[model samples]
Target: MVNAHQTFVIVGGGLAGAKAAQALRAEGFTGRVILIGDEPAPPYERPALSKKFLLGKEERESLFVHEPAWYARHEVELHLGQSVTELDRAARTLTLSDGTRVHYDKLLLATGAEPHRLDIPGTGLAGVYHLRRLTHAELLRGVLATLGRENGRLLIAGAGWIGLEVAAAAREYGAEVTVVEAAPSPLHQVLGPELGEVFTDLHREHGVLFHFGARLTEITGQDGMVLAALTDDGDEHPAHAVLSAIGAAPRTALAQSAGLAVLPTQRGGGIRTDAALRTSDPGIWACGDVAAAEHPLYGTHLRVEHWANALHSGPAAARSMLGREVVYDRVPYFFSDQYDLGMEYSGHAPPGSYDQVICRGDVARRTFVAFWLKEGRVLAGMNVNVWDVVEDIQRLIRTGRPVDTAALADPGTDLASLAAPAD
Candidate 1:
């Protein structure tokens, strides 16, 4: 029995869940489908939340992946503001927080992650904040409005994309933002030293403070609101508010409660899944930040918390659940635009994983492209103010092409002609 009319239930109605429902219908699956989410709004893009959205450049509606009317036309039921409290994998039933049960032949778990909290004191104070959703940005905006042109202070904990982006956004608000990172440089774990130095200089030039190799000791407060935070270096910095952008963990309690085999998170804790994006229980499928899928590019299973990866991962899992043989093989890419400067990277080139770091143009002027080469193959590249070379590098990374870094740095070289032979 093919179960063509069987119900397909997708949990966590973010970009992943929304797209899965759309792709399933587009692929001509005449099955009963429902999308569940804890939020009251339609699934929307999140990358813009910390950058363009927070900067007040884009309206909320423009961030949505698809319009609500499209879903209506397709007849996909969206359960907004509804939380799935329990999942009975054997029975394929999902229990909502309001005591309603949803049954499905195939279950997709796109439940994303939550902001990592600071264990320091004064964490519950009012002035402190973390940016994850559009609501979070609006709340921060409200706080900034009251402190307009005052000696405002924002202490951002963690040096990840969210933290750095928030730092840039906070500075734009004229908030004296100080970023505290335990690591020596921003994006050290992801981009390594040379490229991270570029980010450090860029942010400092934008009037943002950086506290590298520092740890949070305690967050001081008064009147139940935040005031300042003391660091392990025996220094106290006054702050109007504190934000813990430390990172996030996969929201996997429901899956764990339902007896699903969640994967081990080496970088941080997150739910694990097989190559097909299936949990230990075959009836259940997971994707996005929640399910840790084996990364063919990274050579280990990882939970990619990026908008592009989440979008592709969601539909890939959905298609697999529909008994289609499509595998989600994404290039694992993410971008950050801070202060009119654009930075993009693809794939995680291992530490010293490459034999060469070639630069075209000037690094001091911040107008150059850096390439990562392993043996004779181009693994990755970082470009700033150099779109031409970045595009050429992107193509090679995707195709696993070999190239001569020395020739790439030559100003007169036509990179397209020098690209490695296609395998």
Candidate 2:
């Protein structure tokens, strides 16, 4: 019953959109596929923008999800640098920025997210930067090198993943780096105080300065160039450059304008969708950072902004679009690399959600598995410098069985064996 004349229009040219298109063709869908993006370049992975790519260890070409020729070979109509300005749900059409009307039998909104800009003065200064795009990374790579050579200082706002990774890269370049965070510790929101202290100590050992419990209030500049950053605590730090890495907001304007329901800001705002990634409009679907879909495991709508989410959810949404039964219950996952520490975190354990965080192996040596437990049941786990245990950790969380705390923390016990036997 596949309609050869059917057309599927996908908005946003990030990893999710690209993967969805790939999935459609892989699933033998003969329908027309049109992919549109605001960025001029084809769909690329965002993780490298803050890590290897920013450090100059990765090439620009390596960031793309697929080779440029792959799209043409797949017969996907690629439209770059043109944003869909209007979504007419009634007419089943999208009006691009260039005034071209594109009709679609099914619509996919993979419109990712944009970095949160600071409302403070001097954000538009020459040396003030944000790194949410490939072009931004390209610009920052050169700037960090110049600052390193001059022994210049980099004042970074927010100590999240992006800020910390950039600090690591800048230190590798021999640049003086200082981070300003409102939380008491770096990654305080994600890792909590105990584990967040590990990262704080790690960066300090690498010569990165931190000003905790304070945030940037203003950026002072001269001749439209950044000079220094003034913090809320009335402290001023001299800087040749400043990076605003507060966070990102999902791009949901198109969904909202089209009368699609979106989660409230408190619920990590994004277009609301069902377990199958189907939005309020039956003909439209959402995925990746833009889709706050109901997770079957959690029994709640959750929006995850990570590379893995986009990597898997894209294909999952594609299957749903093809009328396949889909329930997105993938465990939340993300990884980070800073200095010599490489860590992968699986499952959700935001602050109060976990009762205690237990560790296996050596914490001081930076080779350990930290598990967040609630009522003796594992909710999330993070392994630093440890490999090949993600499956066990995810399994523990999925089983929802309370584990023996001592056995769970003992390196001698096998994690897979800790889960209860199925009936």
Candidate 3:
């Protein structure tokens, strides 16, 4: 029922690539499948790296997306520790770091993203760390354990989810934590000031020091080890180690090198793809963090770096590659856990996009659902310590219908019913 001469190649080794490979086999693609990764380890989930694994509560073996034997058993040609250096779009071939040339009838780029490295001085110090890869997490885990035992100080350079999550884990280890951020509040760009204050208060209650409205100007060290960090405010915080948690940039160099269209950095830069996840080149497809696909729901190109995006988009792209009608329009979603607080945010409401924020529960008690509305319609929703309502929230947003302000803000009202027209 298929062309035996066809071969599909996936160019990333993260969650997206692994899921794409799995979907290819499940979709009855009998042709050869090759999965290439620069990292030596098999694909693994990244959320735990900043949460339980960093806190030593989760085992490294549990992070993998699939057992090592699954690849062999599924006949997925796994190429570990190899980087795809050149993409010859004309010939449909990829040149690897080891000088190996592989041909493919179709290609999927799930290159994922890389953590932004601090350009400040002292980043090369022995105690400085980043948390994008498994190896980095493994090394940081040991450093945190030692710092916890010694009652050492840890200074973080950002207050995004990764920075705050790492700060929480450090507190669990009894390490002194200080976070320096340029924004007035944590997650200012994403959550706006109102909700960002919630995160700031949560971390502060956990004994974490926050130097808001400041940026890390320099990291001072001695004998190749971190000693202190200097902020733009001329204050120096003593630190035994430093973690740069600024954020991540999508890896689009490969796609760009092959003349694929990419979005500008300001637009959440990634390889630009259509609604079907097909890139400028029809023979090539992209998904996960690297693919900035046009979203029919949002009416724009979006590239989300959350685990959910990678989890769903890979299979979507795989099906699209198999010539099935596909539209990659999943609502953006991500969750974070810090100290005693856990939150799941669905939809996008970056600052200036929404007109008002309304809450349905007790914000002081940290059990609430906050909605971002534009012109009285639900644009996004976030539930803090609240569960079983994501579907309702998403439905409300999808309906694009205005609801009664009082009913939208009432916890007693059924969210499902609110999606309908008012009586």
Best of the candidates, lDDT = 2
TM-score, every prediction: 0.93, 0.98, 0.98
lDDT of 3 by residue, 26-103 (tens): 999989999999999999999999999988889988999999999989889999999999999999999999999999
For residue 330, what is the lDDT in candidate 2? 95
Candidates, ranked, lDDT: 2, 3, 1
Residue-level lDDT tens digits of model 1 in 108-130: 98999988788877788888788
Which ranking of candidates, highest TM-score first?
2, 3, 1
Cα lDDT tens digits for candidate 2, 108-221: 999998899999988889999999999999999999999999999999999999999999999999999999999999888788887998998899999999999998999999
Each prediction's whole-model lDDT (CA): 0.81, 0.93, 0.93
lDDT of 3: 0.93
Clashing pairs in 2: none
- Note the residue pairs that clash in candidate 3: none
Report the Cα RMSD per candidate. 2.5, 1.3, 1.4
Residues forming the 10-long window of minimal summed lDDT in candidate 3: 1-10
